[model samples]
Target: MGPLNGFTVIELGGIGPAPMGGMILADMGAEVIRIERANGTDPKQMRDVSARGKKSVVLNLKQPEGVETLLRMIENADVLIDPYRPGVCEKLGLGPEVCLQRNPRLVFARMTGWGQEGPLAHAAGHDINYISLTGALFATGRRGEKPVPPLNLVGDMGGGGMLLVNGVLAALLETASSGKGQAIDVAMVDGAAQLMWMFHGFQAIGGWDASQRGANLLDGAAHFYDTYECADGQFISVGSIEPQFYALLKQLAELPEEEFGNQNDPALWPELTDKLAAVFKRKTQAQWCEIMEGTDVCFAPVLSFMDAPSHPANVARNTYIEVDGVTQPAPAPRFSRTPSTVSHGPHSLGQDTEATLAAMGFAESEIKQLLESGTLGR
Candidate 1:
């Protein structure tokens, strides 16, 4: 029901980012068909939180028939996402060159940590390593603290998966005019570097203190743009950068507005942060929420995963949905005319094998032959 409705996508199932990219496509109402290994995937992946709204098909790529089957599916697919190392798919005879040769209008997307060709192209790494090389990991933590990993969100999902999806969508839009598709080489490191573009400008302007991590306008160095611990050990975030907002914060906290001089004075940040911390610690998070939750003090209590869905604002917007008894975030960037919907949870390995192949125009005899040849796992 979304903008990408009727678009056919074939996902070469891999761990992490590729699955996430397929999920994003599926959430946007694309017909995503994931290719699983004949041996099947791990139970953890079978129930992956990001695997909703897709179908699964299994194939033994080691067999020639299996590779042929995939190529046939590529002929009908608009987008083919290959999440692997540079030559892995080429070695399997399923690379972009081969696939695009079969389908000139197919958008081929490759998501990798390094890239198609580089010194570290074939090196094994994860989200942390990818972001580490991009300067993003170095600037994520406190001034004096060890850099904290921003989960796998930055490199895996945000940089890798989201970037791949964006590339695929752009390629699709272009294909509408050109009637020809192209390959997208998406690297997690490249995406991570792209994400750090804003910080590069901040550094060039001499306003950012690149020497230290936390010493920046938006990096928790300023008192008005940081999180504080309350009396009950709970926390709340504040972003009162504007003069009126900062004044309101002081007024609500019962602190003298005159004590805070020159709001942008970097030299006075340490002292101002100390004072604000003390004031915030004197009250429970709930007590502070009562006074500032809806005000321009730019306040919000730090909500845990369990409590976030029930928060008044989140509840009002239905930010989360229950799928198979599990509560997870809803499809985002909502569409007004063609809204997206999750019809089911992740499919078990090869759960849709026969059905998907049949829908792809395989005859029952062909499906049975492939199954008997061990190329297709039913």
Candidate 2:
């Protein structure tokens, strides 16, 4: 039992960030019910690392009876999360206005690439497009090269999903005090821009450039913070930015004294990077890990997805687990009092349709009719 043990959340299924947000809440002991469309489309296709710890219920919102069924669940739910193009929810009659009316204490969370009322709110977009609009994508990768996709982490997970989770939790707290709920419009573009807040401060102080990609301190312009490829073609990331750590890095790498003469000089970054690269290439990633894993040099081998779980630190901490024969990272931010656990794996679409309906006070006869009319998927 985690902090959110008693909370019930209704997740209107979409993709990406929305599911990820639901997973976070579900991991924290919230009872997350995924409201899937009663269509022929398979739900398992979208089931990846993010769809764990949830129950699935399908309903045909296009049908009047289906809409009634959803309203009934909303009445009992503490939160309802949806990732839809601005007007889609309103059209489906599951919008915040209707749902909140049914349950004034419902925390209605709307996730989108571009927010609710913007001109591009209805425009089709994904993580890349959203980050691109906010100048976030342009800030990654090397100078004079197209921006590399950062695996959709910043926009999709960090921005969209994480922000929605925070907002929903905050709204829940507010509801506990005020006895009312509100809507949260979490936009990926907005959240990505917020993620660059520190850089924004640097720009205001004239220490940052908006146009120079990969030329900033944390973006790889500084020799102390960057990735290097080894002779084995494996990579390692290093971040010895502080003076003490940088000194340790130099000593560990056995660099000559001349290289230390201008450690902070921007003009020397390229030369230093080349020298460090050559030295790192002399050893395999594992060899370097043995020497520097827990040192002040701030070094770690860049393990692949499959290799990450086996690392000593991760394995010792139980950072990843195998569930249903699937290896995935464990839920984060440990709670000592009431520890969290994954209730179950990603569920089949509409697997709990009748169960959810019955819990929401739907009679068996009505459930049979809805199921027979294709208003609820089996």
Every model's Cα RMSD, please? Answer: 1.3, 1.3
Residue 63's lDDT within candidate 2 is 87
- lDDT of candidate 2 at residue 34, scale 0 to 100: 89
Over the stretch 1-378, how does candidate 1's per-residue lDDT look in tens digits? 888999999998888988888888899999999888867664235567677888888898899999999999999899999988999999999988899899999999999999988999999999999999998888888888999998899999889988998899999999999999999999999999999889899889897876788888888899999999999999999999999998898889888767785789988998999998999999999999999999999999998989999998999999998887789989887999988888688777788899999998999999999999999985
Candidate 2: misplaced stretches above 4 Å? Answer: 40-47
Off by over 4 Å in 1: 42-46
Angstrom error at residue 244, model 2: 0.3
Over the stretch 75-145, how does candidate 2's per-residue lDDT look in tens digits?
99999998888888889888888988999999999999999987898888889998898788898898788
In angstroms, how far off is 126's CA in candidate 2? 1.0
Overlapping backbone residue pairs in candidate 2 total 0
Error of 1 at 272 (Å): 1.2
Per-model TM-score versus the true fold: 0.97, 0.97
**Any residue pairs clashing in model 1, and if so which?**
none
Error of 2 at 246 (Å): 0.2
- Highest lDDT: which candidate? 1
State the local distance difference test value for candidate 2.
0.87
In candidate 2, list every pair of residues with a backbone clash. Answer: none
Look at candidate 2 and tell me the lDDT of residue 364.
95
TM-score of 1: 0.97
